[model samples]
Target chain A: MSEFVEQLALCVERGKVNRESLYPPDLHGQDGTDELAKQALEQGLKPDTILEGCILGMDRIGAKFSENKAFVPELLMAAKAMTAAMTHLKPFFQSGAVKRKGTFVIGTVAGDLHDIGKNLVAMVVEGGGFEVIDLGTNVTTAKFLASIEEHPGCSVGMSALLTTTMVNMEGTIKAIKEKYPETLVLVGGAPVTKQYADKIGADGYSPDPQGAVAILNKKVA
Target chain B: MTSFERLQNRMVGNPVDRPPNFDIMMQFATRHIDKPLRDYYLDHRVLVQANMAMLNDFQLDIVQAISDPYREAFDLGLEVSFPEQSLPISTSPLLREPSDLARLTTVDPVNGRRMHDRLEAIRLFREKVGGCTPIMGWVEGALAEAADLRGVSTLMLDLFERPDWVIELLEFCCEQAILFARAQMAAGADIIGLGDAVASQVSPAWYRLYALPYERRIFQAVKNSGGIARLHICGDTTLILHEMATSGADIVDIDWMVDYQKAAEISDNDGPAICGNFDPVKIMLQGSPEQVREAVINCLSIGGDKNLSAAGCEIPINTPYSNLHAQTAALSEYYSMA
Candidate 1:
């Protein structure tokens, strides 16, 4: 709740990456998340406390997106700001001075080259404190299994933008569950619905990025 | 009545034999004719064959030239690759930096290879079904073309990072789209469908600022050229439904996530005809014929007089023939009862 931490949260929420960043003109020439985080740490603030600022900022922007009060541009800017602040916290995370919520592996299912929806969820989830492993586009069932083996207990998220490709999510989920029965699975995209998620036996379905964060948080909680 | 007459009449709330089956089918059409997606995209002859098959077999009323979104981007110097069995993709965006905007040139649709291919398709459609069916040619919405050339995420960030540059890029894209749309119209297209799938992802404010004006311009050009303008934006467009209604288009595609009743209410009496609001994945692809029939009936009932029958977007390529038939049958049955 100190001055720098508060400003850092504001910077992330407004998407001001640094002082040189001209975005969000209201905060022009002001210290961004990068400077605020460094200053907060130099003043002996706990890394965990500083991390709270990032989470709070992302949560605020994520909620706005969910309510239709904001859109992809705002969320992308917030993620960029969060990434700028995370650069300063990376060493703390490596040294075990900070901890992440969980791991979420995501990808666009096979035969569907669209990645905008998948990437949005990955960025928002990362800002929500999860370690995200984005497998990129055209991901097959074998790739999902391999990533599960690499990151044990990591929840999986699959995306498909086409109706034809959405069926691929079912086969991919079935293959993942067959190998790692305990791994949580989620499916989402423009064509995916909650009913289809249930039909495909996915653990959860989210219509938006913050909704994905909520689902992932619920499972771990 | 001819398919062309049915569609034109339906848009103006005139009585027709049945609601026009305006389902957007590209992959499904390719599968119906058993052609590779690449052939369907790159070869106008293959595209014409696929569409003709859909018209004969599934009662589809529109012969469309919408193979992929890359035609404009590719002709504008973007690196596009068409996999044999997959949709086209542009791995490397053309505008990597803000200054890269200078690299874009105004492309003549008639001279550009991919754009010319679409014109060829329009010409063929006119030759084959000129008077009987509506021929729809397509172009990307300006914002969508910008996203295609600059990448979705980067352009999104650019909207905030460099507002003026984004506007300039949009202006360039708008000019190209207008040119491509005009070319198609000249080549015998009765209707021009503009796909702005990325527009649904932006907030209403951004949509009004960056997307709507360009859409207005393109639709205005289509109308001025004596062509029907159809606007198709994929995904849940509930928030911007009102704005979409005012975009100068004659028909606006309503995706499944949007409420059909709400769309009709928002458009009211003076707006464009509502063309869809069914779950292409759940009800059309995965549902039985009985379910598809009921969904079409329900959608048409909600959409009222100014409605065209269609799935929310493209039907899945593997959709059962019976399910597709159910769509046409439902229209006939519903209208007969009324």
Candidate 2:
């Protein structure tokens, strides 16, 4: 509702990080998410309100990406802009002034060293307002289970770019559901599909980062 | 008909005994010979041995030197590590900063360790089955090599942030690919497979500006060397299929997500041969032999005579032997009846 919050949302949606950053040429030399979020907070706006604006921006870019109106560059820039704004809100989050929706544990399954897809999903999910525990690439079943144990009730997401590593998703998902039956497990990658996801007994599968956010949000809701 | 004759006839739209199978097998071939993936990627003898086994066992028409994307990057001085039975990893990117492009230098394919290994694979294939089957040698497309050196996420941002620097890097990568392709051709490769997998992640406009020109250059070099050029970009490439058709390649691999009918319709009537549309995981690794046969027939029907029977990408290492057999078997059965 506030002008500063709205401006911050535009900066994130358009990927304008700061006045010094020259991307999105249309927003050149203007105050970006870094300044606008600071301004929004200084003016007494709630951290939650600012976070809502950030998530709104991410949602817009994600929608555009899914429709082919945007691509990885646009999404990465938006995530970067969101990250810039989130820095000012970190203190609030630390002091119990801001609360996250939930935790999402994600990784590229074992035997798959590719992390681009896994990283993108982590960024988008974090931008969608969740505490993301990124386990990095080549994450084995034990690491995933340990993370789940540490972050109880956290939704699990696995990615594998190679078809060879995709089979690892099955073993990891089976191990997780057997131990944490109620925890939602999602899988995705270049080779992963809804059919493969279902065959592996995964709770959900997404083809894009934005879709991954939507799935996590729906389950959390 | 000889495998080479079958492929040549299919390329010219001539009737063949059956569609020539062009399945990309990397890890699958490695597992076939009971060799570690590390050996398959590093040793030409191991790669050639595995491929020869594929030719003998599956009646594969093409023997390929595609092990991983890191071959050129590793030779380019990137610190790439090879696991015993896993894909290579490059944790520390060579170009951590845009200015780091200055430090990058081109390596001669003959002298470069990994690139030379691929050429050796082609030479061995020529020695073993020179006149019988086609031998495909691979090089990373300019954009893909750039991503390998600069990291995918960082290079993606560089496309927007440092356009000039990205162009410089692309030009350097393109030159290396052209030289590598020409060297492979001279080493006895019948076809050169250029993989620009990163192009699928960018917008069509960026692809045209940053990736397409370089791909055209590399493919043109392959053609100049009397080698058939094949373009393979992984993922849903429907958005850029029209542009890809004009990239000077003889064959353009269509990933499973792109509709076979749509890809066929987009290419020029005299365009590159279209090869694939089957899901490697669903139809080959997970599906029964019956499903594999059905998918092969369906793709052939949609892709018409210009189609090559193959999976969308590499055959998964664990795909059931029966399902792998079903693809070529389907073609033989259907075409025999026809």
Model 2, B78-193: lDDT tens digits are 99988897888888999987888898889999999999989989999999999799999999999999999999999988887889898999999999998899999999999999
TM-score of the second chain, each candidate in turn, equals: 0.99, 0.99
- List clashing residue pairs in candidate 1: none
Candidate 1 lDDT over residue span A1-221, tens digit each: 66666777788889999999998998999888888888878988888877888888898899999898888889999999999999998999889889989999999999888888898899889888888999999999999899999999899999998876888888898888888999999899987889989999999999999999999999889
Tens-place lDDT digits, model 1, residues B20-124: 999999998999889899999999999999999999998888999998899999988999988888888889899998999997798999889999999999999
lDDT of each: 0.91, 0.90
Residue A205: error of model 1 in Å? 1.6
Chain B alone, candidate 1, TM-score of 0.99
Each model's RMSD to truth, in Å? 1.5, 1.4
Off by over 4 Å in 2: none
- Cα lDDT, model 1, residue A45: 88
